[model samples]
Target: MRFFEATHKYPFDWETVSLASFRKYPNDKTPHVQHVEVLNQEIDPETGVLKTERLIMVKQNAPRLMMKLLGGSDSSYVLEYSEVDPRDKTLTMHSTNLTFSNLLTVGEKIVYKPDPEDTKNSTLFAQSAKLSADGVLSRFSSYIEETCLKRFHDNALVGKLGLEQVLHKILAEKRQERGGAGNMAA
Candidate 1:
């Protein structure tokens, strides 16, 4: 038997999801984006490079924005929020925006786990890519702009390992399966 401690409830901030979800909801009014202060940017001290997340930002207190994105037609309007606190922000949490449309359910519950080191903070965040509506691949690539992507050291092997390895494994399995199927047919 496995037991997990449930996290506390926090109103989901729709703004961060909204901008990242631009691909889902493209319109004339682009949610009035502004470059808010770089709250707590998650950086690798050893690499001297911004870690996996850097593009995400908290837009005040607009939890409804997520609803707008999830909801279609009538609910596409913008949701408002309060001022974003730089001190209360974190790159670990508010780093990548996800572009998922099916995540917005009216009565959906959001769970918040306060970082042990920073208790006063409650990020309207999902800890892992699998749990989040947007899968890991989409979320990871969305962080950097195309122009600057070249400068990043990790770009060279973007699809080399995961994709190629996956393909190689799939082909090998298919060959084995084909051989078995042919023998059975004979």
Candidate 2:
């Protein structure tokens, strides 16, 4: 098994970043992400935390040879669980690939929170993922893990760019709404 961890600072507030994180899919930068379906959601009455489970469909980025060996389709499913703590201004998510569990397992965790070091409105993003190969792929586990890790690095940048695109779009909408409201009052 191999693992990687990284951190980034999104020049947006925690609320904005957290909101964009949930809505970060379906962007041109990360076209691999196809669909997301909320399986369950609920709010804690006492703690006021929101919990949700979602299934995400994404295109598999495996090598062609690996794909042929596995004889699997291009699409893969991932199961994710997340929590939002409004009081703490934190959002956390955990996800695991479900399609090729017999041969490989990929698990990830991500967290978003207010940047403690940055007084200038920003959010800290931290993420980690573990990759492992088993069964038929065990012989090439190290190489597979290394390849996946390299891909993860590229995808991480793409994911952040996707979120930024979403956030920009949302901010523009907000600006337009405010402009419309001002015009209405005039």
Candidate 3:
């Protein structure tokens, strides 16, 4: 198993960042993401936390070796689970690939919260991921591990770019609504 973690600072407040995260898909930067289907969404009556389950379809660009081993699949599904705590100003999300589990599995967790030092205008985003391969691929474990880790790292950057794009769009809309100058704060 290989693990990786990344931290990013967003100039937008936590609320804005959280809202944008939910709308991150369907953006140009992440064309690999094909669709998102919400399986369930509800608010906990006792804690007032919002919980959601979603299925996401992504077009796979598997390596030649992986494609050969997995019969050349073109897409895969991921299951996403998330919880939002308004009172705590936190959003926690976890996702796992539903396909190719035996050959390769990628699981990721993300936490979004208000930056204590600059809660009004800044948010902190942290993510950690685990990559593992087993089963018939054990003989090629090293190769598989390396490929999966590199892919995950590259995709992490793309994910961040996609979120930033969504945040910018949201800010632009808010500015238009206020009839303010075209310049954005960040």
Candidate 4:
């Protein structure tokens, strides 16, 4: 088993960033993420927290050795769960792969919170993941884990860029709406 952790700062408020995170799929930077299905979504009336579950299909670029272990399959399904607490200004998420878990299981967790020093314009993002390999691939566990972790680390940067793109698009739309409304008033 191996663990990875990373932190990033975004130049956007927590609320905006949270919304952008939900809309991050179907972006150009992450072509590997083919499809996303929202399995469930609801708000906890008592706690006022939003909860959601989604299934994501990914076309992973597995290494040659890993592909052989997975019977030549390059696609996998991941189950993602997330909770948003507006009162706390925080969003937390967890995801794990459901297919080929025995050969390689990767579980990730992320937290997005308001940056204390710059709460109005900045957000803090922290992420951690665990990668484990077993079963017939146990012999190559070390190599597999190393490769998978490296891939994940690189993907993290791409994910951040994707989020930034989504956020920019949303903000631009809002600006256009306001500008159009003002023009009509004039």
Candidate 5:
């Protein structure tokens, strides 16, 4: 008799997966989609179960004033941001719009000066960021480092218990159920 058992050794690496996915399919579309991202993963030694939560974000570019005049989205960029909540076992994704013209280079700073005379202009200007890809990337990376990491660990633990381990237990139970009720033939 051949015995088959599922283990928690399923392979996965987020950075590698992300890069590989992008390399395979590069794009400059209105809605940008990040790959199926692994927020966090953990394995239970006792149960031999793997737990993971995937996150994927899709964003549509917002039309800039010039783009709106020139036909929106043609000159805009959309970024999709996704993060997995390990603790809650949830996936979150959102799209943010950016103008191609407003992007700032790395190390460059754009300061917003509010005009006291025009309150409306002041409010708009105050809310606007430097609008640089580098700045956004920097902030995004920092957020992932600070907030997502801990949450991922917690999620992994929960998944190991609630999702992965439970799967194996159910499988094992099914196998046992199929083994045979009583007739022992020697």
Candidate 6:
């Protein structure tokens, strides 16, 4: 098994960051993410946290050899569960690949919260993943994990850019709304 983790600071508050995350997909930077379907969504009665589950379809590029070894398809499905705690001002999500489980498994966790250093204006983004291979391909597990780990890292950079793109849009819309409201009041 192999592990990967990283953190970033978004120049926005936790609320904005969390909202951007929901709209992060369908952006140009991560075209590999083709579809996202919400399986269920609800609010916890006691905690008041929003709970959600989603099914994601992704098509990522991989080495030809690896692709052929893993059924020659670049598309895979992932199941993700997430929680949004308004009281704590945090959003956490965990996901795992559902396809090719017998050959490999990719489990990922991500979190967005107020930055301890700059709580008001910045948000902290953190993510980690575990990669493992099994079945008759155990021998090549290291290679598979290493290759996928590299791909994962590559995707991570673009993922951040993609989220930022969405965040910028959200901020822009908010500014426009405020401007329009101010004009009306004038």
Estimate, for each residue in 104-172, the C-alpha lDDT of model 6 and write its tens digit. Answer: 799999999999899999999999999888653667888888888999899899999999999999999
lDDT of each: 0.31, 0.89, 0.91, 0.92, 0.33, 0.91
Give the 10-residue window scoring lowest on summed lDDT in candidate 2.
Answer: 132-141
lDDT of 4: 0.92
Give the poorly placed runs of model 1, Cα more than 4 Å off.
Answer: 1-158
TM-score against truth, every candidate: 0.21, 0.94, 0.93, 0.95, 0.24, 0.95
Off by over 4 Å in 4: 136-138
TM-score between model 4 and native: 0.95
**Each candidate structure's count of clashing pairs:** 1, 0, 0, 0, 4, 0
Per-residue CA lDDT of model 3 for 1-186, tens digit only, reads: 789899999999999999999999989988889999999999999999999999999996778867876785789999999999999999999999998886778899999999999999999999999888865456787788888798789888999999999999999999897765544543
Q: Model 2 off-target regions past 4 Å?
A: none
Instruction: Give the per-residue lDDT digits (tens) of candidate 1, residues 32-125.
Output: 2333323333444554434222232222222354336445322222121122223334323222232332331111112223345544532243
lDDT of 5 by residue, 104-158 (tens): 2211111122233542322111111112233335644454233323433443344
Each prediction's RMSD over C-alphas, in Å, is: 20.1, 1.5, 3.6, 1.3, 21.3, 1.3
Q: In model 6, which range of ten residues has the least summed lDDT?
A: 132-141
Q: Report the poorest 10 consecutive residues by lDDT, candidate 1.
A: 1-10
Residue pairs clashing in model 1 are 61-82
Off by over 4 Å in 5: 1-141, 179-186
2 or 4: which has the higher TM-score? 4
Which ranges in model 6 have alpha carbons more than 4 Å from their true place? Answer: none
